[model samples]
Target: MIAWFRQHGRALAAAVAKVRAQPMTSALSALVIGIALALPAGGYALLSNLSGIAQRTSIEPQLSLFMSTEAKAAETEALGKRLRADPRLAAVRFVPRNEALAALRRTGALAEVFAALEHNPLPDAFVLRPRDAAPDALDALAGEYRRLPGIAHAQIDSDWARRLAALIRLARSGIFLLGALLGIGLVAVTFNTIRMQILTQREEIEVAKLLGATDGFIRRPFFYLGVVQGLAGSVVALSIVSLSLAVLDRAVQSLAATYDASFQLSHLAPADAAAVAALAGFLGWLGACLSVSIYLRQIEPS
Candidate 1:
């Protein structure tokens, strides 16, 4: 175990040395990988922020059951109890006609119009939050409630939520497609970088082979090099994302203030950032393994 550790340490040191030897090349390669990764990662961050805003803004699909004006208080209470008992509903809150009317009166714009009315035109209502936010499920629940006794109307103001959900899905698909293409490009970049390194050290590799060095020994440093480059690139990518979010959040904050809303873009969580780094490292390792396997065989000692 000690020997294994020592060998790995030596290989890692050598990889670091090589990268330092060609600072400009390594930095440029890392920059390329960072930019590619940032595109998809930024999109993901944007989607996450939007989803957060939806949740914070209470975009949950809600069904409002307006009771018939003729419905007695007893009947309204019974309907509220029935709705509360339903397992599919997350919550059910009853709003009495009087309370609804008072709320309307409190609103500056509607107070004048409502004050002139002789009788309260507003009906008793139960605001329902369904456990399932799926469009079909919401529609089904709304249809079911509409048929209930004393329910004059079952209105769902979930069209905006549905549209937002659809848009998020489409955006996720686009991000995935973009990430996949960029991932392939990253692999190609590493492959070419490793190929060039192998070509540059052809004579050295042949000498090591003649000295009876095992393939694993010759491959170790290159593998470490690839992993290092990938990790560095991920650092660059995260930095770019952080900086961009900071800039965008300022503008978003100013815009949100106009509407008297509090919102800010969230940074990637620790787990998510770690996953990105792991994925980048794997891509780099894969590219290095492929390049070394193919080119190393061609340079066998004569």
Candidate 2:
């Protein structure tokens, strides 16, 4: 392992030096990779932060139970009893039609309609909350509760929760797709770069093959070259992403402050950042390897 490290270290240094010799080309290529990578990387980071924000945001599990106009008072109370007695349910409240009528009267905007009605058409209903916080379980329970006797309907109280979860899922899929495209682009960039390098060093590969060097040995330096390029690009990409997130976090904090919200901005954790860098490095190595292997096969030693 020590010998291998020494060998790789020497190869990495040579690759870095070679890249430095062509500053303009290196800059342009790295920038291309960085920009391509940044979009999806930043998107995933934003989603990560937003998900954390969602968890921190409090949501009251309010279930609305609507009754049919044919429903009577004793039945509503009995329904509330069954829901409240269930182990899965955390809370329940009965909303009588009289109380609902009073509430509308207090609003004043509906006073004329309330006064014109010969009889209250509103049915008595119960509001129920599930003890468990899982949205799927909540939905299932709502479905079951609606099928219960004398209960006309049961539904989630907040449309926002459902909508937000859907939005997150959509964003996640989009980010995944975007990341895949970018990865392919990275490989293309690395492949083209290695191809150019191969052309420049054609004589060296021919001479090495004639000297009895195995394809594996001949491929080592180029693989290292690719790894270096990838590692450098990853560093640059991650830096851009982190800086962008920092700016976004500050903006969010400022906006939250304007609304007097207690919400805080989230930073990308260490493990995630490391994973991003490692992924970039692997992609770079793979891209380089593909190009070198294909070209090496075609080179005829004269």
Supply the TM-score for candidate 2.
0.72
**Candidate 2 clash pair list:** none
Question: What lDDT would each prediction earn against the true structure?
Answer: 0.88, 0.81
Give per-residue CA lDDT, model 1, range 78-147, as digits (tens).
8888888999999998888999999989876668899999999999999999999888899999999999
Q: List the residue pairs that clash in candidate 1.
A: none
Q: 1-302 in candidate 2: lDDT tens per residue?
A: 99778877777777887788888888877888888888888898888877876666545677888888777677777776777789987888888878988887766556787989988877776777778768888889888888877777787885576567668889999999999999999989988998898889889888988899778767777887787777778778888898898888788888877655655555567897787778777888899899999987787554
Off by over 4 Å in 1: 56-61, 65-93, 96-154, 300-302
- Residue 20 in model 2: lDDT: 88
Every candidate's CA RMSD: 4.5, 6.7
**What would the TM-scores of all predictions be?**
0.77, 0.72
